[model samples]
Target: MQWGCMDFRLLTFGDLRLVDGKGSIVPFPEKGLLSICFLLTSSSTQKARAELAEFLWGDIPLDKALANLRQTLSRVKNRQDELGIELLLIDQATVSVNVRAFTNDLALLTAVSQTNPHTALEELLQLGRWDFLARTEVIGGSGRMWLRTQRDRIKTQMLTTLRDAISAMSEGADATVIKEAALRLFEAHPEDETVYQILGETYAGEPQLESARHIFESRRKYRWGELPVDPDPQTLSVARRLFERQRSVAPQLREQATPQLEIVPPVPRGPPKLVLLPPVNLASSHQTAVFLSSALLEDITVGLCVLKTVTMVAHYTAEKIALHLDRDAMLERYAINYVLDTRLNFDGSIYWLFAQLIYAGNDEVIWAERFSMEAQNLPRQHREIAQRIVASVASYIERNEFSRDYFERNPEAYRQYLLGQRHLKRLDLPDIRRARKAFQTALKENPYFSPALSGVARTYHLEWLVTAQGDARLLKLAEEEAGKAIATGQDIVGGYHQFGVAKLYQGAFDESIEAFELAETISPHYADVIADYADTLMHASKPGEALEKVERAIKLNPLSPDLYFWTAASANYSLQRYEDASAYIERMADPSQAARLAAASAAMAGDTRKAKALVRKVKETYPDFKIDTWLSIVPLREQWQKDQYREGLRRAGFD
Candidate 1:
């Protein structure tokens, strides 16, 4: 690192440098920079990495300290590069500027900014230039008191600068600087028309007089219009005198104020920010480990994402927070404007959920709700949970996203649908049968429950997967149930997703493709829909296109069901992207499923040992596994395709 001085002290990282008091460059890893900024503003010379990491990455494990450090260090470099400034390094452990090395404007100002008049006033006057980190004030770590304290100091100095500029003008010191300072003062005291009147009076003999009068009159009018009253008599008389002289500057001033006023219009507050915190796996059922987490987040985020003005933080960010940490600090750290956090409890017969949304600024509990749902209605119950949260947030904010009647008039049908959903998740024959009965009951209650209809289709879809007592009968039942669901839910994306799965089950490639394509348009982030589309497209002889859709799906929902990844790997295999196929096949949930896909992908990618090991793993899961027999049981798009894939595995030593 090198430090150079001309107008600023500069430190360079690589080719990049952060100049203290001059230049425009900054490093990447914004959060790291923010962390450093927090440290620098503190009174302590050093802060523990653990404390910093806990604050910044509250949800991340301790092992990620190095990764977080590297990220922050890179940002310091980027910031220096952006500003062409010298960077001061304290390394990663703690960030502080040496009192002897160089004086930082932020440091000097921070001293006086905290108290009435710091003894360093004379020194501060020299260093106080523009608003301290004016551009950066709008961004995050804005939640930190340090930035606010620093900005408060900067503005106070700005006021001092304005006074000095005005003083210099009166003493005939620097006419140009005085005018610039007068404008800045005008900005700071937006409600003060007196400054405008004084400025107009001072510039009366020059060409600037008209411009000054325009400023005076505009402020007077703004105060009057917003307040719906005339200015005070004393202020009005001064402004009236200025306005009379400033007639010529009216048009130019009007042009400037138009866009400025519009830019700051009040923001509409919509549904509260809802962050679905990690649901505890109380039963250790672990079967629903990924499913419960992914599905809950999916429903909540997707539901909240559609609303305008509701600031919902992404699911990944929230779950990253440790459960034991304070919610307020997390909200502040994440810059979350508002939060709707939830928790779940499951007993043998019933599931209960409790949720609340709160404002970060005041810790005000904005909205709260509790739900009790039976095991039989889990799917419908989850959907209701999503809808209730939305409805509650909507009522508080006084805005509507869904149709008002969507759930209000059909409570019974919604309940029955929830029962069906609860049953479908069971993934057993008895559960599927029970789910089918609940779905039928829900449809009987209200025929337009598209989500419940989808649930019924899903029940059939799972029954086929269980490969129960009668293959032909179960497959036919799934097709008919899916058809009934499609009849009701065709216009809804969930309808298409379920129906598409049904068609895929029956090997109806063309129909499945159409259903998934339509579903993808309604909600581009649905992993299941995109994966099914890839499958259908592969079957339709468009493997390349199929692979692209699945890749897009992967990007949209990174932690979707492993089954989705397996489907994508299969698509990649069809497209001869064997390495890419292997990359995705690695994420499969079920050991047996992982083995089959890994064996195929490993063979295609020429990993002989991996292929043999995967085949062995599959045999361990399914002892009756023979390459030919397993291929027959698993549904590949074509028999020849399956034979060719198995042959490649055999050649790679998957006996």
Candidate 2:
């Protein structure tokens, strides 16, 4: 595994880098580095040159791709004499990595995973980041696909190692290691109640009674708060029992400390509960179709969770409840207000998914639709189908819920308000202007409509974001509109939410936080409100709590929008967790939306190459982006926070 007189190491864990004997980074062209990575990580040490060429440059002509591959291989060969190490072996038709001359972190991890998984887990944690080939950006679609596949493979490997280590805990593994592994796993898979159980047990076994109690109590609260309608009965039972045990043990340890654990069931009196049962597969033999149907239903559930007026039962619990033979009794037991029952059937060629909405109170079928799709297109068409279903359901619910206090008295005004909301969610300058027009029309119909007033306020706020201009006039107008909304409808969540956003942008941190808190009080499960509150908290220099709030928001709206990821990334950046910030940015549908933040994070993380590349991209996209101008408008509560961001940007070669 060693070269004659030099040690070469390829690091593929956090970021891809090549280190020489003296631990200095060895620079290579992008293609050369990628070629090396592809060969090193491939199933076989050797690959056809044509395969490597297609992988790296599949978008180009075959002749040009082969030529480019040859040039990249020649470049690598040219470095051998200067570096005194052979890194690749090339022939007329094949390329192979000199596996013995260099060692790679991935290979080392794989080896350790088979031998000592505890060590593998420790190494995975020590990497401080899980992004593989983080700095490498591939140009071709095929290359991007390969990159995604490799990242998933590495993540699965890490999780498997963590699970293996946890399984070995019964064989007298270190308790600390087990706790850390459990925590890491929990971070990656928060929805898995098994991880929570393991974490609570690990703490309890440590005899840290208070910590164990907190863990169990937190689990219980999460189940009640996030999955409010129907939490997994087994998870709730385990958490409650463990919490009581911890409370019982605490008094014995401290003599005078009498801890009390309370298990309060969630009262189903807030928003109406809407449940989407798992789709019933007519062709049970087609398990793949059944899984896709369930996935589509889950997607619809997540999309519906964003609606402020309806509470969605957790998908896991809905699946369990769907199995009950007596559907009416089950609905009554869960206090379900609406049910979306779906059935999947295949008629030889096309798959038909029939969905219906029923009022659980009277067993009335309110709406039904049958969607047809090809079997091959099921996976790719789920998002669109989910969106259609969610939109139809939301429209029906909105029409039926006119009795709520915030609904405009005039039907025309409510129609205009709905139009404004659709435009506002697009989050662009053109849409903002369009939204303003719709809101203005609504105001003409009913001047006292608070929802329309709030919509007007949001248009101004969104304009500010889209323009990236520090326009005090825009903030003033937005705040004024929000104030009117709040004065007209004190109980409505939209007014409070819009007011908080405007106040935050105006640097009124206390007022903004108070407004968002009130909004939460009004609509406790409003995912967008919680996300904006998290953003306010981050700017107010309370990133730890901000992260917690955003995580809670994500739980409420599992398939959240780009803003949630941006808020999470900002919080992580403020906390100096650069890798985590980058990871969150990558989760966004468009990472370029936060390119500046990504650049700063990479710079702070000591990846200057990546930082500079990102800076270049930012400049290409936004030519007028001056760091000082953006910072002035960012509304950071503390000067130190602004300075930290400025420093990172400057280090990343930004103007």
In model 2, where do residues sit more than 4 Å from their true spots?
1-310, 313-355, 358-402, 405-408
Q: Give the local distance difference test score of model 2.
A: 0.71
Candidate 1 residue spans exceeding 4 A from truth: 1-275, 278-339, 343-354, 358-413, 426-430, 468-473, 623-644, 652-655
Among the numbered candidates, top lDDT falls to 2
Per-residue lDDT over 398-494 for candidate 2, one digit per residue giving the tens place of the 0 to 100 score: 1111223334256567556656755664687898999899889989988888878988999998888888667889987887787677656655667
Tell me the tens digit of each residue's lDDT in model 1 across 1-655. 4444444432211122234444655334445445545556655655565656544543335458546756666666676566554333545575553434433445554565554332233444444344444444222111222344444445556566445434433332335544554465456556434454444434433333556666766765665453222344444555565455446555666455321100111233433444566554355564343344444454456444434334444454455542535766766655555666666666666566666766667878877766664333444545555565554453222122132244344656655655565566557789888988877887787776766667777777787787633365666555555545544433355666776776676675655665675566444444556777887776666777877887766544444556667777777777678888887766665536666766877887788888888777777767765676656555557666776677666766555
* TM-scores vs. true structure, each candidate: 0.46, 0.46
Best candidate (score: TM-score): 1
Question: In candidate 2, residue 359 scores what lDDT?
Answer: 83
